[model samples]
Target chain A: GPKVLQIPSHQIIDMGQMVTLNCDPVSNHLYFYWYKQILGQQMEFLVNFYNGKVMEKSKLFKDQFSVERPDGSYFTLKIQPTALEDSAVYFCASSLGDKNTLYFGAGTRLSVL
Target chain B: GQQVKQSSPSLTVQEGGISILNCDYENDMFDYFAWYKKYPDNSPTLLISVRSNVDKREDGRLTVFLNKSGKHFSLHITASQPEDTAVYLCAAGARNNNAPRFGAGTKLSVKP
Candidate 1:
């Protein structure tokens, strides 16, 4: 079992503000992903990244959202000018390959007012 | 800590029949096990879970069977309904690994 740590288990921000969620994936994992889930809803896939580039992304991955893992450091998801609709739990996951099992963070709950 | 396998990609069963979903693991340290259910366009949600300490667990019409020796587990849904149709995912975790590994997924269709 590899731990995927998500910073600040809970985050509260005002609408139109900016926020950055950080994740420390498994050291040997190469494929990375982000999922969004609202309470009582299903876990929705946002985007997947590999080899320092985005492999695929869903429409839910709005233009305001961006992901990057710089120089082999923490993988990050940043949202600028956040909207109220963006409020949900964001989970970060990583695996050794795209087809491998994903190790997920406990999730960062974003509350935008 | 890594491999969680769901051999079946899809299943079709009659309404009110029993629906079985199976999963396997490659790690011996896997002490935690769980299942997730997902609908189209929705995120997967935790359904039922059990630890290695127990061999079976039941909730309403859902049951989880674990066989440590075989390194396998399964979810059995009785009285299956159309509403039960969704993608099912299996997850396994080891004592030393905090991250639980998940299987690809198995889509289930209950014909009414």
Candidate 2:
């Protein structure tokens, strides 16, 4: 099975600081996605990127949050001036296309204190 | 409001029995439905999926039954094993939609 690897499995950052989480998606995957889960709650959609652009984003994707995959490298999620509410496990996923099944990473748990 | 809902927070089933997980949705426009399984400290993995055009689909021991009129779908795992214990999450995707909405998830415990 193809795997999506997330770097820095756990991170603790101070509130108002900037934090970036990295995700290495499958080699041939075209569509990338980010999801957030807090505690034992449902996984909430954050944003999806394709062709180096944001295809769609949910309300949970605040203005402070941004995503980019520079030169087909790691897909990175940067939270500028992180907030306490932003503390959650962020999972990165990728698929051949929007209609295809996704391959997910273990997730990067971010804790903003 | 939650577009997709899984009412049961958890369920217990005996091994070799059937494990049925239910899900309900509020959207009629959704054409694709899927089920994902996840273990603790791991990401959810796709278990099975079905499009609106089909009412039921089966693969091995897993079966997905879709009821459009009821806006509900279910996953039935027959001959369930202890290894089948995991959290099950349901998701619905609309046509041309970029992302799918997910349910709160139901944790299943298969007792040996």
Q: Tell me, per candidate, how large a share of the native contacts it keeps.
A: 0.00, 0.80
Q: What tier of docking accuracy does candidate 1 attain?
A: incorrect
**DockQ value of candidate 1:** 0.06
lDDT score of residue B10 within candidate 2: 95
lDDT of 1: 0.85
Q: List the residue pairs that clash in candidate 1.
A: A1-B97, A42-B43, A43-B43, A43-B44, A44-B43
Q: Which stretches of candidate 1 lie over 4 Å from their true place?
A: B1-112
| Residues A1-113, model 1: lDDT tens digits | 57888898999999999999999999999888888878755456678788888877777889999999999899999999899999999989887854445667888999999
Whole-model alpha-carbon lDDT for candidate 2: 0.94
TM-score of each: 0.57, 0.97
Q: Give the alpha carbon lDDT tens digit for every residue of B8-36 in model 2.
A: 99999999999999999998889999999
Model 1 lDDT tens row, B1-112: 2277888889999999999999999988888898988786554567888889899999999999999999999999999999999999988766533446567789999999
After superposition, the stretches of candidate 2 with alpha carbons farther than 4 Å from their true spots are: none
Candidate 2, residue B81: the lDDT equals 94
